[model samples]
Target: MLKLIVNNLKERKIGLHELNSEELTEALHYAVANQDFALQREIGNHFTHIYDQTDEIPYWFKSEYDDDVTIINFGQRDKVVDWSSVTLEDCLPLTHSKHKPLLNGFKNWLLAVSDPLENGGAVIKTSTVKMRVEKVLSLIDAILLRSAALQLSLYHLSHITCDFWLSLFKAMSENGPINGVYDFTGRTVELVKAHVKSITQEQVNAFASKYPFVIRDIAEDDLTLHLAKQERVKACCWLYSQGYYKYGSSFIATGNGAVLAILLFEGKIASPSLNTPTSTELWLTEKERSTEYRPFNTENSKTSTAEATINTYISMAKLINTNIFKDNASSPSIEATKALSVRKINDLVILKPAGRTQTLHPDVVFKLTRQSFEFVLKFQQDILDA
Candidate 1:
């Protein structure tokens, strides 16, 4: 029956999409029974393609593969969480039914576990747990909306496999909807291990770093580290202020604008050359070598946290004030902006404070720093043009 249909499709006597769910199911079973995995895969692919073109998956097709396929076929009336519209209240279980937790017993188990070194044997904060849960849900919602997976459920610790965790991590990393959350692929292993609940160590070790969770608790003593990170950011600002830029096809592709500069500032890597790549060259390089794109080696920008982001920006502002404004100017205050806004006014750049939960590019803070203003203007018009 399947062979006859395939021949019909080849002869253009019948459309692949025109096959009913019963026919497709029989084809799927026939392919599987005959150990023809390639045929089964092609059938799934064609199913997806049909849905994509029509914006509707056949009801029978959805019923058969709802759990097996990546693209979810949610009913029109079924409620789906919208991360963009989420508020503190929307995250509350009492307020929203779809606002579900990722792991079932992990939170309670983690709370029971004690950390003698921190918070007088308290392992984590209630507020921090709430935030992490919200974040994880947001990520799941984003993944679901993009049809990354059908009916993804991380709620049952026993049901989740190592492959599921890795696939989830990969999806989060590649998906555009959750880039604001963190560099999911870049720093997945650490974050996943950090948020491990009641799951056994052996199970956690199975993934070998590709676990799950954006649920790592923020350390109580993070202020000290924040101060040190700020100093490094300050050094980066100083480099930009001095008109020194690092560009190379190899190293430059490792991270985003700010991360590259920070790596250069720390002397962890050496500068490629004094010559900066032109904007056109930069664009071409990004297009050509996307795999080596932006290495996020540092812990600061790898995790999703407002403190790391705000600290870097504040440090940049402070550096600008000290270097250019004689440490007395209020125009470039050390305050993290309440709003993420940037605009240029002649030689000076006006930047507003980033939100408490905001994540921003370090280059924005560096370029908009009062001290780096003249250099950026000159670099743009003269250096690149020439």
Candidate 2:
């Protein structure tokens, strides 16, 4: 077992400092005999026993793979991850069952990396792990879709080159063979490709050995954040551009418009009043109850949702610049509220004002809220250009 552990460590390029072979061997034997490997207590309790004593070691004798292990946690450091509960068996049954041993070994790798006792490394927030997992799942779905189109299974593409991953991302960004249209900018695509290329050959070998490691790489990639940001901006743009609120973007630049947008955006004033004119407004009121905000990472607020919201806000700001300043035809309109907030005229989104319920076309409402609408169309371009 010691030989096996040492060989595994060497294969993974994980090095230990200060501890001699005898001490390291003794520690593993103690952990194996005394700790519950099933519960993954080896990392937490055993490492603490070895390293936590002040006279034993002043600093952690970590391997180059320490940060990589933390990164592989997918940002969920606080909560223990149950591989059984989060397995890909249901989605990729053929490969998953065939690769169970490899999967088990990789699970050991994951456990060894994230020591909650902080002997090995620091744990990250649970939310980040969840979000990364979600994003990776979506990307895998897209990849599988693309694979099916090519008449291939994931197993068939084992040990593929980074170029393969880059092409997959490119296809996803361009709305090519992928299921959904991503419409990511060329720069975003390039950046994503660069991220894919950044994976070391040794890291790729580690991932290729275990199917879940492939999934882990997908989750760990920078593309996950970019995808998260894009989706957020698109959702925000859709909500505002469709006239789901009391007032459109014409009022967005003003005090009242800002108040309305803020109220809706912040989930403060959730719905249209009982007297609101349109069914669309009523529908929006219901949707707002379940609305989620994801912002970019801020110095003070680095939570997953806050970071997503920040990214969306930045993308929206870029969109606003395009809509209000770059367009030659439409000047910024400062008008706030109409007599009636919103209504559906045939297929048009209608806004009526004080005098005689004067109607504006849905195009006019969309134009007034063009910044939000344009965000959906040009977010990636704006992000890269900025």
Candidate 3:
């Protein structure tokens, strides 16, 4: 039994027998502080028998002994008592009203049993029982610390649902400290964060309606878009940043007046993509015949139709220039009135648009590329010149 106990403690990195007298005493002090009366009583009994018989106490005792005691008792009178029969309540100091005795009789009893000079009229050598007692005491100390760690793990688990907490508790109890319970908790938290709950199409439509520029040209069939692994990770991080955990989607607004409706999808998806067109492209395409793409109320501007069209072209050019050279140091200046010039290049019209002060890089703004702006402008110009 002692060999088994030593092996168990060694497995946990607790070198009980190897500790010096001072270190062993300190370890015993820690165990006493934790109020593990059951282990204390077991250790006390083992050493008491060793001292009483004047026999050498082995490092480990093989047989088990029944020394169970209830931790509750009240209004006990001071009298001659058998230390062996003393309950946990008898050892505890009277810090509360229920406990009548102010003195810790159990601690006194343990000291007397382990001390060679004090053991009841027994001529037992201190050296004979000291090592055995220290080993047992050290084991008790380790058990107390493990028990506290288990309680702390349970406390953290309490934050989750009761069912989950119970399930985790059972798992820990069965195969505990094998893979750290705390590590298991961290993994559980990550799993919860990655859990993407599905939302109805109605919810998706409502979100799209609120941010038309962000959710532009989303195909009817593509309403249920699945997220890629990288996208899912980003979505999870974004959701956490927003102080939300339930919703697996968000409408990320960009600098260039565009909103991106990001949604997280469950399970693996093959070639997952956001099949949505830009609002600017769609707007430019629809107003190809109009002099200016923007609705020009005659009341809002005194500029002529031709001037408005030129101004609109300039604005589109600036937008495109902004997308292309947004990160470049020596980008061209964007004009407010008109594009620098529009020239025909084979089947395509090359608009020499100036760069804007406020550029929209593709990385900064989701899906707003230089090519997108160029495509819209070229298409619009072709229809107008036709």
lDDT for each candidate structure: 0.34, 0.32, 0.31
Sorting all predicted structures by TM-score, with the top scorer first, yields 2, 1, 3
In model 2, where do residues sit more than 4 Å from their true spots? 1-92, 95-120, 148-159, 174-386
Per-prediction backbone clash count: 8, 13, 2
Alpha carbon deviation, residue 107, candidate 1 (Å): 37
lDDT of 3 at 128: 40
Output the lDDT of residue 191, model 3: 40
What TM-score against the true fold does each predicted structure earn?
A: 0.19, 0.24, 0.14
RMSD of each: 25.8, 27.1, 32.2
Lowest lDDT sum, 10 consecutive residues, model 3, at 263-272
What tens-digit string does per-residue lDDT give for candidate 1 at 295-366? 443434333323333233222222221212222111222232222222211012222234544445687667
Off by more than 4 A, model 3? 1-170, 173-180, 183-187, 190-232, 235-386
Output the lDDT of residue 234, model 1: 35
Best by lDDT: 1
TM-score of 2: 0.24
What 10-residue stretch in candidate 1 is worst by lDDT? 267-276
* Residue 232 of model 3, lDDT score: 35
lDDT of 3: 0.31
